[model samples]
Target: MNLRQIEIFQAVFAAGTASKAAVLLNLSQPAVSKAVQDLERSIGFALFDRSTGRMVPTAEGELFHREVEQTFAGLSRLRSSAARIRDFGSGEIRLASLSALSTNIVPKAIAAFRQRHPQVAITFQTQMSSTIRDLVAAGQFDIGLTSDEVDATGVTVEPFAIYRAAIALPEGHPLCAKPVLSPPDLHGEAFVALAPEDRTRQKLETVLAAAGAVPRIVLETPYSTTVCAMVQAGIGCGLINPLNAEPFLGRGLTWRPFEPALYFCTLLLTPPGRRGSRIAEDARTLLMSFAGERPALPADLHHVPEG
Candidate 1:
Protein backbone atom coordinates (compact mmCIF):
# COMPACT_ATOMS: atom_id res chain seq x y z
CA MET A 1 0.00 0.00 0.00
CA ASN A 2 2.18 2.89 1.32
CA LEU A 3 5.93 2.85 2.08
CA ARG A 4 5.42 2.73 5.86
CA GLN A 5 2.88 -0.10 5.43
CA ILE A 6 5.31 -1.94 3.14
CA GLU A 7 8.11 -1.51 5.67
CA ILE A 8 5.98 -2.84 8.49
CA PHE A 9 4.72 -5.74 6.36
CA GLN A 10 8.23 -6.69 5.28
CA ALA A 11 9.51 -6.51 8.85
CA VAL A 12 6.68 -8.75 10.10
CA PHE A 13 7.17 -11.16 7.21
CA ALA A 14 10.89 -11.47 7.90
CA ALA A 15 10.57 -11.75 11.73
CA GLY A 16 7.55 -14.10 11.50
CA THR A 17 5.77 -12.71 14.58
CA ALA A 18 4.27 -9.35 15.68
CA SER A 19 6.31 -9.20 18.95
CA LYS A 20 9.58 -9.94 17.12
CA ALA A 21 8.74 -7.45 14.32
CA ALA A 22 8.02 -4.75 16.95
CA VAL A 23 11.44 -5.41 18.52
CA LEU A 24 13.17 -5.17 15.12
CA LEU A 25 11.21 -1.99 14.12
CA ASN A 26 11.45 -0.35 17.59
CA LEU A 27 7.62 -0.23 17.87
CA SER A 28 5.08 -1.65 20.30
CA GLN A 29 3.65 -5.12 19.58
CA PRO A 30 0.09 -3.72 19.26
CA ALA A 31 1.22 -0.98 16.85
CA VAL A 32 3.00 -3.56 14.68
CA SER A 33 -0.14 -5.72 14.53
CA LYS A 34 -2.31 -2.70 13.60
CA ALA A 35 0.10 -1.77 10.76
CA VAL A 36 0.06 -5.31 9.45
CA GLN A 37 -3.77 -5.37 9.57
CA ASP A 38 -3.95 -2.02 7.75
CA LEU A 39 -1.59 -3.29 5.02
CA GLU A 40 -3.64 -6.48 4.55
CA ARG A 41 -6.96 -4.61 4.45
CA SER A 42 -5.66 -1.98 2.01
CA ILE A 43 -4.34 -4.66 -0.36
CA GLY A 44 -7.33 -7.03 0.25
CA PHE A 45 -5.00 -9.96 0.86
CA ALA A 46 -4.77 -12.40 3.70
CA LEU A 47 -1.03 -12.17 4.33
CA PHE A 48 -0.69 -14.07 7.65
CA ASP A 49 -2.38 -17.08 9.16
CA ARG A 50 -2.60 -16.12 12.86
CA SER A 51 -2.00 -19.12 15.16
CA THR A 52 -2.14 -19.13 18.97
CA GLY A 53 1.22 -17.40 19.48
CA ARG A 54 2.75 -16.97 16.03
CA MET A 55 1.98 -15.51 12.55
CA VAL A 56 2.57 -17.90 9.62
CA PRO A 57 2.83 -16.68 6.01
CA THR A 58 0.11 -17.57 3.53
CA ALA A 59 0.94 -18.53 -0.09
CA GLU A 60 0.00 -14.97 -1.21
CA GLY A 61 2.31 -13.46 1.43
CA GLU A 62 5.29 -15.55 0.26
CA LEU A 63 4.79 -14.42 -3.39
CA PHE A 64 4.24 -10.78 -2.36
CA HIS A 65 7.46 -10.76 -0.29
CA ARG A 66 9.54 -11.87 -3.28
CA GLU A 67 8.68 -8.61 -5.12
CA VAL A 68 8.95 -6.52 -1.93
CA GLU A 69 12.46 -7.76 -1.24
CA GLN A 70 13.56 -6.69 -4.74
CA THR A 71 12.20 -3.17 -4.14
CA PHE A 72 14.07 -2.97 -0.83
CA ALA A 73 17.27 -4.03 -2.59
CA GLY A 74 16.89 -1.07 -4.97
CA LEU A 75 16.16 1.22 -2.01
CA SER A 76 19.35 0.10 -0.31
CA ARG A 77 21.36 1.00 -3.42
CA LEU A 78 19.79 4.47 -3.64
CA ARG A 79 20.77 5.06 -0.02
CA SER A 80 24.38 4.06 -0.71
CA SER A 81 24.51 6.38 -3.72
CA ALA A 82 23.22 9.25 -1.57
CA ALA A 83 25.93 8.64 1.01
CA ARG A 84 28.61 8.61 -1.69
CA ILE A 85 27.42 11.92 -3.07
CA ARG A 86 27.56 13.44 0.39
CA ASP A 87 31.09 12.16 1.09
CA PHE A 88 32.56 12.93 -2.34
CA GLY A 89 31.37 15.43 -4.95
CA SER A 90 28.58 15.06 -7.47
CA GLY A 91 29.93 16.69 -10.69
CA GLU A 92 33.17 17.23 -12.55
CA ILE A 93 35.37 20.33 -12.57
CA ARG A 94 35.98 21.35 -16.18
CA LEU A 95 39.23 23.21 -16.94
CA ALA A 96 40.32 24.84 -20.20
CA SER A 97 44.02 25.80 -20.38
CA LEU A 98 46.64 26.81 -22.92
CA SER A 99 49.25 24.32 -24.06
CA ALA A 100 51.96 26.50 -22.55
CA LEU A 101 50.87 25.59 -19.01
CA SER A 102 49.36 22.19 -19.86
CA THR A 103 52.65 20.33 -19.75
CA ASN A 104 54.19 21.71 -16.57
CA ILE A 105 52.23 23.89 -14.17
CA VAL A 106 48.70 22.68 -14.80
CA PRO A 107 49.50 18.99 -14.52
CA LYS A 108 51.25 19.50 -11.19
CA ALA A 109 48.27 21.41 -9.86
CA ILE A 110 45.89 18.67 -11.00
CA ALA A 111 47.99 16.02 -9.30
CA ALA A 112 47.97 18.04 -6.08
CA PHE A 113 44.23 18.61 -6.24
CA ARG A 114 43.58 14.91 -6.69
CA GLN A 115 45.45 14.09 -3.50
CA ARG A 116 42.88 16.01 -1.46
CA HIS A 117 39.79 15.19 -3.46
CA PRO A 118 40.53 11.77 -4.79
CA GLN A 119 36.96 10.95 -5.83
CA VAL A 120 36.23 14.24 -7.56
CA ALA A 121 36.39 14.14 -11.36
CA ILE A 122 38.38 16.62 -13.44
CA THR A 123 38.30 17.37 -17.16
CA PHE A 124 41.31 19.11 -18.66
CA GLN A 125 41.33 20.56 -22.17
CA THR A 126 44.18 22.26 -24.02
CA GLN A 127 43.45 24.85 -26.65
CA MET A 128 44.65 28.22 -27.96
CA SER A 129 44.27 31.33 -25.80
CA SER A 130 41.33 32.57 -27.88
CA THR A 131 39.48 29.26 -27.56
CA ILE A 132 40.06 29.21 -23.78
CA ARG A 133 38.56 32.70 -23.54
CA ASP A 134 35.47 31.58 -25.47
CA LEU A 135 35.05 28.51 -23.29
CA VAL A 136 35.22 30.52 -20.06
CA ALA A 137 32.88 33.21 -21.42
CA ALA A 138 30.22 30.69 -22.43
CA GLY A 139 30.46 28.81 -19.08
CA GLN A 140 31.55 25.68 -20.96
CA PHE A 141 34.53 25.38 -18.63
CA ASP A 142 34.68 25.95 -14.86
CA ILE A 143 38.05 27.72 -15.04
CA GLY A 144 40.34 28.91 -17.83
CA LEU A 145 43.90 30.12 -18.43
CA THR A 146 44.95 31.98 -21.57
CA SER A 147 47.67 34.12 -23.05
CA ASP A 148 47.33 37.91 -22.85
CA GLU A 149 46.68 37.94 -26.59
CA VAL A 150 43.08 36.91 -25.78
CA ASP A 151 40.80 39.95 -25.64
CA ALA A 152 39.49 40.75 -22.16
CA THR A 153 35.80 40.52 -22.95
CA GLY A 154 32.77 38.44 -21.75
CA VAL A 155 34.69 36.71 -18.90
CA THR A 156 36.40 37.99 -15.77
CA VAL A 157 40.12 38.32 -16.41
CA GLU A 158 43.22 39.16 -14.37
CA PRO A 159 46.95 39.27 -15.00
CA PHE A 160 48.42 35.85 -14.49
CA ALA A 161 52.14 35.85 -15.24
CA ILE A 162 54.83 37.55 -17.32
CA TYR A 163 57.56 34.99 -17.85
CA ARG A 164 60.76 35.55 -19.85
CA ALA A 165 61.24 33.71 -23.15
CA ALA A 166 64.47 31.95 -24.18
CA ILE A 167 65.78 31.02 -27.58
CA ALA A 168 65.72 27.20 -28.00
CA LEU A 169 68.62 25.96 -30.12
CA PRO A 170 69.61 22.62 -31.60
CA GLU A 171 72.67 21.36 -29.68
CA GLY A 172 76.13 22.13 -31.18
CA HIS A 173 74.74 24.82 -33.47
CA PRO A 174 77.11 27.70 -34.10
CA LEU A 175 74.85 30.20 -32.23
CA CYS A 176 75.27 28.08 -29.06
CA ALA A 177 78.80 29.51 -29.05
CA LYS A 178 77.27 32.84 -27.93
CA PRO A 179 76.33 33.00 -24.23
CA VAL A 180 73.33 35.21 -25.11
CA LEU A 181 71.76 36.08 -28.45
CA SER A 182 71.02 39.56 -29.67
CA PRO A 183 68.87 40.39 -32.68
CA PRO A 184 72.05 40.68 -34.74
CA ASP A 185 73.09 37.09 -33.86
CA LEU A 186 69.82 35.81 -35.35
CA HIS A 187 70.35 37.74 -38.60
CA GLY A 188 70.21 35.44 -41.65
CA GLU A 189 69.67 32.34 -39.45
CA ALA A 190 66.80 29.91 -40.09
CA PHE A 191 64.08 30.60 -37.47
CA VAL A 192 60.96 28.88 -36.13
CA ALA A 193 58.39 31.43 -35.02
CA LEU A 194 55.38 31.22 -32.77
CA ALA A 195 52.04 32.19 -34.36
CA PRO A 196 52.09 35.73 -35.74
CA GLU A 197 49.15 36.78 -33.53
CA ASP A 198 51.10 36.09 -30.30
CA ARG A 199 52.07 39.27 -28.49
CA THR A 200 55.41 37.73 -27.50
CA ARG A 201 56.16 36.91 -31.13
CA GLN A 202 55.14 40.43 -32.18
CA LYS A 203 57.46 41.90 -29.56
CA LEU A 204 60.36 39.72 -30.72
CA GLU A 205 59.71 40.75 -34.33
CA THR A 206 59.54 44.41 -33.39
CA VAL A 207 62.87 44.20 -31.53
CA LEU A 208 64.46 42.50 -34.54
CA ALA A 209 63.09 45.09 -36.96
CA ALA A 210 64.34 48.01 -34.84
CA ALA A 211 67.82 46.43 -34.93
CA GLY A 212 67.63 45.98 -38.73
CA ALA A 213 68.11 42.21 -38.37
CA VAL A 214 66.16 39.56 -40.27
CA PRO A 215 66.14 35.79 -39.81
CA ARG A 216 65.02 33.33 -42.48
CA ILE A 217 61.45 32.52 -41.36
CA VAL A 218 61.28 28.78 -42.03
CA LEU A 219 58.27 27.72 -39.98
CA GLU A 220 55.55 29.01 -37.60
CA THR A 221 53.33 27.28 -35.01
CA PRO A 222 50.98 28.13 -32.12
CA TYR A 223 52.36 25.79 -29.40
CA SER A 224 55.54 26.35 -27.41
CA THR A 225 55.96 22.55 -27.18
CA THR A 226 56.00 22.46 -30.96
CA VAL A 227 58.63 25.20 -30.96
CA CYS A 228 60.75 23.09 -28.57
CA ALA A 229 60.29 19.97 -30.70
CA MET A 230 61.14 21.79 -33.93
CA VAL A 231 64.27 23.21 -32.37
CA GLN A 232 65.24 19.72 -31.10
CA ALA A 233 64.69 18.34 -34.62
CA GLY A 234 67.07 21.07 -35.95
CA ILE A 235 64.25 22.38 -38.14
CA GLY A 236 65.15 25.87 -36.91
CA CYS A 237 65.99 27.72 -33.74
CA GLY A 238 63.03 29.40 -32.03
CA LEU A 239 62.20 31.64 -29.08
CA ILE A 240 59.77 29.98 -26.62
CA ASN A 241 58.58 29.98 -23.04
CA PRO A 242 61.36 28.71 -20.77
CA LEU A 243 58.75 26.63 -18.92
CA ASN A 244 58.21 24.76 -22.17
CA ALA A 245 61.93 24.49 -22.85
CA GLU A 246 62.92 22.43 -19.75
CA PRO A 247 61.60 19.15 -21.19
CA PHE A 248 63.75 19.30 -24.33
CA LEU A 249 66.99 20.54 -22.77
CA GLY A 250 69.20 17.42 -23.23
CA ARG A 251 67.46 15.83 -26.19
CA GLY A 252 69.57 17.76 -28.72
CA LEU A 253 68.08 21.04 -27.49
CA THR A 254 69.56 24.04 -25.61
CA TRP A 255 68.46 27.57 -24.74
CA ARG A 256 70.03 31.06 -24.67
CA PRO A 257 68.78 34.35 -23.28
CA PHE A 258 67.60 36.74 -25.97
CA GLU A 259 68.79 40.37 -25.89
CA PRO A 260 66.42 42.88 -24.24
CA ALA A 261 64.81 39.69 -22.71
CA LEU A 262 61.36 39.10 -24.30
CA TYR A 263 58.61 37.86 -21.99
CA PHE A 264 55.27 36.09 -22.49
CA CYS A 265 52.19 37.53 -20.77
CA THR A 266 49.38 35.35 -19.50
CA LEU A 267 45.87 35.90 -18.11
CA LEU A 268 43.70 34.00 -15.67
CA LEU A 269 40.05 33.79 -16.74
CA THR A 270 36.81 32.60 -15.17
CA PRO A 271 33.08 33.00 -15.68
CA PRO A 272 32.20 36.46 -14.37
CA GLY A 273 29.93 36.85 -11.33
CA ARG A 274 29.30 33.13 -11.04
CA ARG A 275 29.97 31.11 -7.90
CA GLY A 276 31.04 27.66 -8.96
CA SER A 277 31.38 24.49 -6.89
CA ARG A 278 33.95 24.07 -4.11
CA ILE A 279 35.82 21.59 -6.31
CA ALA A 280 36.22 24.14 -9.11
CA GLU A 281 37.26 26.98 -6.83
CA ASP A 282 39.78 24.78 -5.04
CA ALA A 283 41.16 23.55 -8.37
CA ARG A 284 41.70 27.11 -9.56
CA THR A 285 43.45 27.91 -6.29
CA LEU A 286 45.73 24.89 -6.55
CA LEU A 287 46.57 25.70 -10.15
CA MET A 288 47.54 29.29 -9.35
CA SER A 289 49.59 28.27 -6.34
CA PHE A 290 51.55 25.74 -8.38
CA ALA A 291 52.37 28.38 -10.96
CA GLY A 292 53.71 30.65 -8.26
CA GLU A 293 55.70 27.86 -6.62
CA ARG A 294 57.61 26.95 -9.77
CA PRO A 295 61.42 27.38 -9.76
CA ALA A 296 62.69 30.95 -9.74
CA LEU A 297 63.23 32.29 -13.24
CA PRO A 298 63.05 35.63 -15.04
CA ALA A 299 59.31 35.53 -14.30
CA ASP A 300 56.83 37.85 -12.58
CA LEU A 301 53.74 36.01 -11.36
CA HIS A 302 50.56 37.72 -10.14
CA HIS A 303 48.58 35.53 -7.81
CA VAL A 304 44.93 36.59 -7.42
CA PRO A 305 43.08 35.27 -4.39
CA GLU A 306 39.29 34.83 -4.28
CA GLY A 307 36.68 32.90 -2.27
Candidate 2:
Protein backbone atom coordinates (compact mmCIF):
# COMPACT_ATOMS: atom_id res chain seq x y z
CA MET A 1 0.00 0.00 0.00
CA ASN A 2 0.96 3.68 -0.32
CA LEU A 3 2.95 5.44 2.41
CA ARG A 4 -0.07 7.52 3.41
CA GLN A 5 -2.19 4.41 3.80
CA ILE A 6 0.53 2.66 5.77
CA GLU A 7 0.82 5.77 7.93
CA ILE A 8 -2.92 5.73 8.59
CA PHE A 9 -2.83 2.02 9.39
CA GLN A 10 0.06 2.54 11.76
CA ALA A 11 -1.70 5.42 13.51
CA VAL A 12 -4.96 3.43 13.85
CA PHE A 13 -3.10 0.40 15.12
CA ALA A 14 -1.29 2.52 17.73
CA ALA A 15 -4.29 4.59 18.77
CA GLY A 16 -6.93 1.77 18.59
CA THR A 17 -9.63 3.96 16.98
CA ALA A 18 -10.13 6.00 13.80
CA SER A 19 -11.17 9.05 15.89
CA LYS A 20 -8.02 8.86 18.04
CA ALA A 21 -5.85 8.15 14.97
CA ALA A 22 -7.34 11.23 13.23
CA VAL A 23 -6.40 13.44 16.22
CA LEU A 24 -2.88 11.95 16.35
CA LEU A 25 -2.36 12.32 12.60
CA ASN A 26 -3.92 15.78 12.35
CA LEU A 27 -6.46 14.41 9.87
CA SER A 28 -10.27 14.16 9.89
CA GLN A 29 -11.76 10.95 11.33
CA PRO A 30 -13.45 10.20 7.99
CA ALA A 31 -10.15 10.73 6.12
CA VAL A 32 -8.36 8.34 8.50
CA SER A 33 -11.12 5.70 8.14
CA LYS A 34 -11.08 6.09 4.34
CA ALA A 35 -7.30 5.69 4.25
CA VAL A 36 -7.49 2.46 6.27
CA GLN A 37 -10.27 1.20 4.01
CA ASP A 38 -8.26 1.99 0.87
CA LEU A 39 -5.20 0.24 2.34
CA GLU A 40 -7.28 -2.89 3.11
CA ARG A 41 -8.68 -2.85 -0.44
CA SER A 42 -5.19 -2.49 -1.93
CA ILE A 43 -3.88 -5.36 0.15
CA GLY A 44 -7.04 -7.48 -0.41
CA PHE A 45 -7.49 -8.10 3.29
CA ALA A 46 -9.18 -6.64 6.32
CA LEU A 47 -6.50 -5.17 8.61
CA PHE A 48 -8.73 -4.50 11.61
CA ASP A 49 -11.61 -6.07 13.63
CA ARG A 50 -14.71 -3.84 14.09
CA SER A 51 -16.85 -6.28 16.16
CA THR A 52 -16.64 -3.82 19.10
CA GLY A 53 -17.01 0.00 19.08
CA ARG A 54 -13.24 0.32 19.24
CA MET A 55 -11.00 -0.61 16.25
CA VAL A 56 -8.70 -3.53 17.08
CA PRO A 57 -5.81 -4.94 15.02
CA THR A 58 -6.22 -8.38 13.29
CA ALA A 59 -3.36 -10.92 13.24
CA GLU A 60 -2.40 -9.74 9.73
CA GLY A 61 -2.50 -6.10 10.90
CA GLU A 62 -0.13 -6.85 13.80
CA LEU A 63 2.39 -8.47 11.46
CA PHE A 64 2.09 -5.61 8.93
CA HIS A 65 2.60 -3.00 11.66
CA ARG A 66 5.94 -4.51 12.55
CA GLU A 67 7.15 -4.10 8.96
CA VAL A 68 5.74 -0.56 8.81
CA GLU A 69 7.58 0.35 12.02
CA GLN A 70 10.84 -0.86 10.54
CA THR A 71 10.23 0.98 7.28
CA PHE A 72 9.49 4.29 9.07
CA ALA A 73 12.52 3.83 11.30
CA GLY A 74 14.74 3.36 8.25
CA LEU A 75 13.20 6.44 6.62
CA SER A 76 13.83 8.41 9.79
CA ARG A 77 17.47 7.39 9.73
CA LEU A 78 17.83 8.28 6.05
CA ARG A 79 16.38 11.73 6.69
CA SER A 80 18.71 12.23 9.63
CA SER A 81 21.69 11.31 7.49
CA ALA A 82 20.55 13.65 4.73
CA ALA A 83 20.15 16.49 7.21
CA ARG A 84 23.63 15.86 8.60
CA ILE A 85 25.09 16.02 5.13
CA ARG A 86 23.18 19.20 4.38
CA ASP A 87 23.95 21.15 7.53
CA PHE A 88 27.41 19.92 8.51
CA GLY A 89 28.97 18.65 5.30
CA SER A 90 29.27 15.21 6.85
CA GLY A 91 29.91 13.70 3.42
CA GLU A 92 33.41 13.01 2.19
CA ILE A 93 35.41 15.43 0.04
CA ARG A 94 37.92 13.83 -2.30
CA LEU A 95 40.98 15.95 -3.03
CA ALA A 96 44.26 15.65 -4.86
CA SER A 97 47.27 17.96 -4.92
CA LEU A 98 50.83 18.34 -6.08
CA SER A 99 53.56 17.16 -3.72
CA ALA A 100 54.84 20.66 -2.98
CA LEU A 101 51.54 21.98 -1.61
CA SER A 102 50.57 18.67 0.02
CA THR A 103 53.59 19.02 2.32
CA ASN A 104 52.63 22.26 4.08
CA ILE A 105 50.17 24.63 2.46
CA VAL A 106 47.44 22.10 1.77
CA PRO A 107 47.68 20.48 5.18
CA LYS A 108 47.39 23.88 6.86
CA ALA A 109 44.38 24.76 4.75
CA ILE A 110 42.70 21.47 5.58
CA ALA A 111 43.21 22.14 9.24
CA ALA A 112 41.58 25.55 8.88
CA PHE A 113 38.68 24.06 6.95
CA ARG A 114 38.14 21.42 9.62
CA GLN A 115 37.89 24.14 12.23
CA ARG A 116 34.88 25.51 10.36
CA HIS A 117 33.44 22.24 9.00
CA PRO A 118 34.38 19.76 11.65
CA GLN A 119 32.02 17.05 10.44
CA VAL A 120 33.20 17.02 6.85
CA ALA A 121 35.36 14.01 5.97
CA ILE A 122 38.41 14.58 3.79
CA THR A 123 40.49 12.29 1.60
CA PHE A 124 43.68 13.87 0.37
CA GLN A 125 46.10 12.43 -2.13
CA THR A 126 49.49 13.74 -3.17
CA GLN A 127 50.52 13.20 -6.75
CA MET A 128 52.66 14.74 -9.43
CA SER A 129 51.13 17.70 -11.27
CA SER A 130 50.18 15.66 -14.31
CA THR A 131 48.65 12.91 -12.22
CA ILE A 132 46.61 15.42 -10.23
CA ARG A 133 45.35 16.87 -13.48
CA ASP A 134 44.43 13.45 -14.83
CA LEU A 135 42.58 12.44 -11.66
CA VAL A 136 40.58 15.66 -11.61
CA ALA A 137 39.80 15.46 -15.30
CA ALA A 138 38.58 11.91 -14.93
CA GLY A 139 36.21 13.00 -12.14
CA GLN A 140 37.97 10.83 -9.58
CA PHE A 141 38.70 13.82 -7.36
CA ASP A 142 36.36 16.62 -6.29
CA ILE A 143 39.16 19.17 -6.37
CA GLY A 144 42.84 19.24 -7.30
CA LEU A 145 45.78 21.50 -6.54
CA THR A 146 48.50 21.37 -9.15
CA SER A 147 51.03 23.47 -11.07
CA ASP A 148 49.95 25.54 -14.07
CA GLU A 149 51.76 23.01 -16.25
CA VAL A 150 48.69 20.74 -16.07
CA ASP A 151 46.79 20.15 -19.29
CA ALA A 152 43.52 22.09 -19.07
CA THR A 153 41.59 20.18 -21.75
CA GLY A 154 39.05 18.22 -19.62
CA VAL A 155 39.70 20.22 -16.49
CA THR A 156 39.13 23.79 -15.42
CA VAL A 157 42.30 25.43 -14.17
CA GLU A 158 42.32 28.45 -11.91
CA PRO A 159 45.42 30.13 -10.59
CA PHE A 160 45.68 29.57 -6.85
CA ALA A 161 49.10 31.06 -6.14
CA ILE A 162 52.34 32.15 -7.73
CA TYR A 163 55.81 32.10 -6.24
CA ARG A 164 59.13 33.34 -7.46
CA ALA A 165 61.86 30.72 -7.51
CA ALA A 166 64.59 31.19 -4.90
CA ILE A 167 67.92 29.70 -3.99
CA ALA A 168 67.59 27.44 -0.94
CA LEU A 169 70.76 27.23 1.10
CA PRO A 170 71.98 25.62 4.31
CA GLU A 171 73.12 27.81 7.24
CA GLY A 172 76.69 29.11 6.95
CA HIS A 173 76.69 28.79 3.18
CA PRO A 174 78.74 31.48 1.44
CA LEU A 175 75.92 32.33 -1.00
CA CYS A 176 73.62 33.17 1.94
CA ALA A 177 75.42 36.48 2.24
CA LYS A 178 74.06 37.66 -1.12
CA PRO A 179 70.88 39.78 -0.87
CA VAL A 180 69.58 38.94 -4.33
CA LEU A 181 71.16 36.13 -6.34
CA SER A 182 71.41 35.64 -10.07
CA PRO A 183 72.31 32.43 -11.87
CA PRO A 184 75.90 33.68 -12.28
CA ASP A 185 76.31 33.57 -8.49
CA LEU A 186 75.68 29.81 -8.60
CA HIS A 187 78.19 29.17 -11.36
CA GLY A 188 80.36 26.11 -10.58
CA GLU A 189 78.39 25.52 -7.33
CA ALA A 190 76.82 22.15 -6.59
CA PHE A 191 73.09 22.22 -7.48
CA VAL A 192 70.15 20.07 -6.41
CA ALA A 193 67.79 20.10 -9.39
CA LEU A 194 64.26 18.98 -9.95
CA ALA A 195 63.57 16.05 -12.23
CA PRO A 196 64.14 16.79 -15.95
CA GLU A 197 60.43 16.54 -16.78
CA ASP A 198 59.42 19.28 -14.30
CA ARG A 199 58.43 22.51 -16.00
CA THR A 200 60.12 24.69 -13.36
CA ARG A 201 63.32 22.74 -13.77
CA GLN A 202 63.25 23.39 -17.53
CA LYS A 203 62.70 27.09 -16.91
CA LEU A 204 65.60 27.19 -14.42
CA GLU A 205 67.80 25.46 -16.93
CA THR A 206 66.87 28.05 -19.56
CA VAL A 207 67.61 30.93 -17.16
CA LEU A 208 70.93 29.39 -16.17
CA ALA A 209 71.91 28.84 -19.78
CA ALA A 210 70.97 32.41 -20.69
CA ALA A 211 73.11 33.73 -17.86
CA GLY A 212 76.06 31.57 -19.02
CA ALA A 213 76.12 30.01 -15.53
CA VAL A 214 76.42 26.25 -15.02
CA PRO A 215 76.04 24.92 -11.49
CA ARG A 216 77.47 21.45 -10.94
CA ILE A 217 74.39 19.25 -10.91
CA VAL A 218 74.68 16.78 -8.03
CA LEU A 219 71.11 15.53 -7.42
CA GLU A 220 67.71 15.55 -9.10
CA THR A 221 64.34 15.02 -7.45
CA PRO A 222 60.66 15.46 -8.30
CA TYR A 223 59.62 17.21 -5.08
CA SER A 224 60.41 20.75 -3.91
CA THR A 225 60.35 19.56 -0.27
CA THR A 226 63.06 17.04 -1.08
CA VAL A 227 65.10 19.75 -2.75
CA CYS A 228 64.72 21.86 0.40
CA ALA A 229 65.69 18.90 2.61
CA MET A 230 68.74 18.20 0.46
CA VAL A 231 69.68 21.86 0.61
CA GLN A 232 69.35 21.81 4.42
CA ALA A 233 71.71 18.84 4.49
CA GLY A 234 74.28 20.84 2.45
CA ILE A 235 74.22 18.37 -0.40
CA GLY A 236 73.73 21.29 -2.77
CA CYS A 237 71.87 24.58 -3.15
CA GLY A 238 68.66 24.39 -5.22
CA LEU A 239 66.04 26.54 -6.87
CA ILE A 240 62.62 26.05 -5.26
CA ASN A 241 59.22 27.66 -4.87
CA PRO A 242 59.19 30.22 -2.07
CA LEU A 243 55.97 28.68 -0.72
CA ASN A 244 57.63 25.31 -0.28
CA ALA A 245 60.75 26.95 1.18
CA GLU A 246 58.91 28.78 4.01
CA PRO A 247 58.79 25.91 6.56
CA PHE A 248 62.51 25.24 6.26
CA LEU A 249 63.58 28.89 6.60
CA GLY A 250 64.32 28.85 10.36
CA ARG A 251 65.41 25.22 10.48
CA GLY A 252 68.96 25.72 9.31
CA LEU A 253 67.75 26.64 5.82
CA THR A 254 67.42 30.07 4.16
CA TRP A 255 66.36 31.37 0.76
CA ARG A 256 67.11 34.35 -1.45
CA PRO A 257 65.31 35.71 -4.47
CA PHE A 258 66.81 34.83 -7.84
CA GLU A 259 67.40 37.97 -9.85
CA PRO A 260 65.39 38.24 -13.10
CA ALA A 261 62.90 36.20 -11.08
CA LEU A 262 61.76 32.84 -12.37
CA TYR A 263 58.19 32.12 -11.24
CA PHE A 264 56.41 28.90 -10.23
CA CYS A 265 52.64 28.97 -10.70
CA THR A 266 50.17 26.81 -8.78
CA LEU A 267 46.62 26.25 -10.00
CA LEU A 268 43.42 24.68 -8.72
CA LEU A 269 42.00 22.03 -11.02
CA THR A 270 38.46 20.64 -11.20
CA PRO A 271 36.47 18.53 -13.60
CA PRO A 272 35.05 20.83 -16.28
CA GLY A 273 31.41 19.77 -16.17
CA ARG A 274 30.94 19.02 -12.50
CA ARG A 275 29.71 21.44 -9.88
CA GLY A 276 31.75 21.24 -6.71
CA SER A 277 29.99 20.68 -3.39
CA ARG A 278 29.80 23.47 -0.81
CA ILE A 279 32.46 21.76 1.32
CA ALA A 280 34.80 21.41 -1.64
CA GLU A 281 34.38 25.09 -2.52
CA ASP A 282 34.91 26.09 1.08
CA ALA A 283 38.13 24.04 1.26
CA ARG A 284 39.37 25.60 -1.96
CA THR A 285 38.76 29.10 -0.62
CA LEU A 286 40.68 28.27 2.52
CA LEU A 287 43.56 26.90 0.49
CA MET A 288 43.67 30.08 -1.56
CA SER A 289 43.67 32.15 1.61
CA PHE A 290 46.59 30.16 3.04
CA ALA A 291 48.52 30.56 -0.18
CA GLY A 292 47.82 34.29 -0.24
CA GLU A 293 49.07 34.77 3.29
CA ARG A 294 52.53 33.31 2.73
CA PRO A 295 54.80 35.99 4.19
CA ALA A 296 57.76 34.75 2.19
CA LEU A 297 56.07 35.55 -1.12
CA PRO A 298 55.21 38.98 -2.50
CA ALA A 299 51.53 40.00 -2.38
CA ASP A 300 51.45 40.80 -6.07
CA LEU A 301 52.59 37.26 -6.88
CA HIS A 302 49.41 35.73 -5.41
CA HIS A 303 46.53 35.54 -7.89
CA VAL A 304 43.28 33.73 -8.75
CA PRO A 305 42.86 32.84 -12.39
CA GLU A 306 39.81 34.15 -14.27
CA GLY A 307 36.74 31.93 -14.37
The local distance difference test score of each candidate is: 0.84, 0.83
Off by over 4 Å in 2: 1-22, 27-73, 80-92, 297-307
Please name the candidate that would achieve the greatest TM-score relative to the true structure.
Answer: 1
Clashes of each: 0, 0
lDDT of 1 by residue, 1-307 (tens): 7999899989898898999999999999999999989889998998999965678899999998999999999999788667646654444688989999898989999999889887667889999899889999999998898999898789998777667787888988898777777899999999999999999999999999999999998999999999989999999999898788777777788877777878888888999888766677788788778776442332221221111
Q: Worst lDDT window (10 residues) for model 2?
A: 298-307
RMSD of 1: 5.9
lDDT of 1 at 273: 86
